[model samples]
Target: MSKPALAVLLTRHPRKPPNILQTLLEVQASLGFVPADALPEIARSLDVTEADVAGVLSYYPDLRTARTGRHLIRVCLGESCMANHGAKVLDRLRAHLKIEVGETTRDGRVTLERTYCVGTCPVGPSLVVDGDVIGRVRPDQIPALLEEYQ
Candidate 1:
């Protein structure tokens, strides 16, 4: 985002308390993803170190320093999901999307990621597309599931 926008957002909410996390969230909400250029300004606005802002950015999986694709596909690779052929599903997704975990597709349509769990162990191979958790995912279902996002 532009520096002017950051200044406007920072000074916009004087009535509310100044907090590091809240400020970052607001920035992310407004800008889609927190821009790398935003760290210094965010730190200055919150009176925290730039490292503080960067740390929060790295610590939170939801807070991304870079912009993501139009759709995010995160497949669960936890123990149960692995047992249920989650790895196979992930491989199929990788091959279909032509991108590895933590990378966005060339067309910027989708981003593929790997998560330890989605809290549905019994379902095993679970898939989360844009925050919607889907259970019992299979390798064959990968194309249809991804097609929805496309």
Candidate 2:
């Protein structure tokens, strides 16, 4: 699916200095995730091996190999957030969604993820739902919040 876009990206940057990381980021940004099928083509374009491309993809937490749900739910696990019952919030979300962290729901509505420090320390236990920063989140609020997305 991403092969054509990758090819165009390669052609567009043919004269520029090789920046594998940036190129990969562009690919992910364009296609949501780094499609495995596009890796070989990307590697060939960059004059590198498939393993090298795969390594870059695996090394970055932000880079996803599989397609995520329509919405991404990131619960902060930083010091302030954890101290403020962030773990409980995560647990509640997982239980309510019936999916573990890093997994998407069967309906493909939401993907749960854990991140560190969203910089909303004053309102600890923050959650970012599809780029909306939600702070002071309570376990009981999860269902209601998720309902909005649904």
Candidate 3:
């Protein structure tokens, strides 16, 4: 997360600290993932029980509670996407990037993840970077797309 986002999170719920989920989400979105040291501060700033925050963080995979790369790659695993060859595309991407699903590149350039859906079914087998949606992605195209980031 960015430094300014921390300020935003703090200000967003000044008198009233956010709930555990919101606090986690805020920190995660801002920092890409929650830092271990941040738990205490987040708990304090949000006025929530630390255990509650930890429990929620432990439960949700969507809520990344650790460091990740700067760029995020979300591949669709929904039925439509799968039918449209999403898995092959994902495999190709992983091979090209030399990183497995749910892992980040060594240089911190990209993080790969799987999503049940992105709701762009009309153009199934979608890939999202940051938040930009790309539909009809071909397996062979993965490397070229990633090259742009490098």
Candidate 4:
């Protein structure tokens, strides 16, 4: 089962502090999200407690514990993005998709999520569509942006 495979992720971590981050990232990459059921397995593999695994999972915004859609849309709402009217962009998406930030479209084509920042604050109002960082996002552009994915 994949749970056993998850242990393989930590096999290379011999003497260092249990690098749970990389292991969890790999798990997420394979399963799309870290299944709650695998938490104990991950901890046992790394010689840490289940709480440690859960802590790392909850601490990282990029990590997700729930299944998302085929296309993951992460909108930035950091101070810089919000100052640049990022909320309007978020509102437009919510209206267009008729789904809130942690929701997937009924058809499961798209999943909308909120991110603090994508490190493009200089441009502000940035977002990520399927891992591609986009800056200077205007509300009017949301339709065309989503069209490409939908």
Candidate 4, residues 1-150: lDDT per residue as tens digits?
365576676565554677889888988887889889988888887899999899999999879898899899999999999899999999999999999999999999999999887899999799898999998889999999898996
Q: Answer with 2 or 3, whichever has the higher TM-score.
A: 2
lDDT by residue for model 1 (1-150), tens: 678978999777654455777787888889888888878887887777999888888888878888889998898989988888789998998898888999998899998889998898997789998889998777898778777897
Q: Which has the higher TM-score value, candidate number 3 or candidate number 4?
A: 4
Quote the lDDT for 127 in model 1: 90
RMSD of 2: 1.4
**Which tens-of-lDDT digit does each residue in 1-150 have in candidate 2?**
545656887677774556778888888787888888888888889888999899988998998889999999999999999899899999999999999999999999999999999999999789999999999999899899998997
Clashes of 1: 0
Residue pairs clashing, model 4 = none
Worst 10 residues of 2 by lDDT: 10-19
TM-score of 3: 0.85
What C-alpha lDDT do the candidate models reach, one value each? Answer: 0.85, 0.89, 0.82, 0.88
TM-score per model over all chains = 0.86, 0.93, 0.85, 0.86
Residue clash pairs of candidate 1:
none
- Lowest summed lDDT across 10 adjacent residues in model 4 is found at 1-10
Say which candidate scores most in lDDT.
Answer: 2
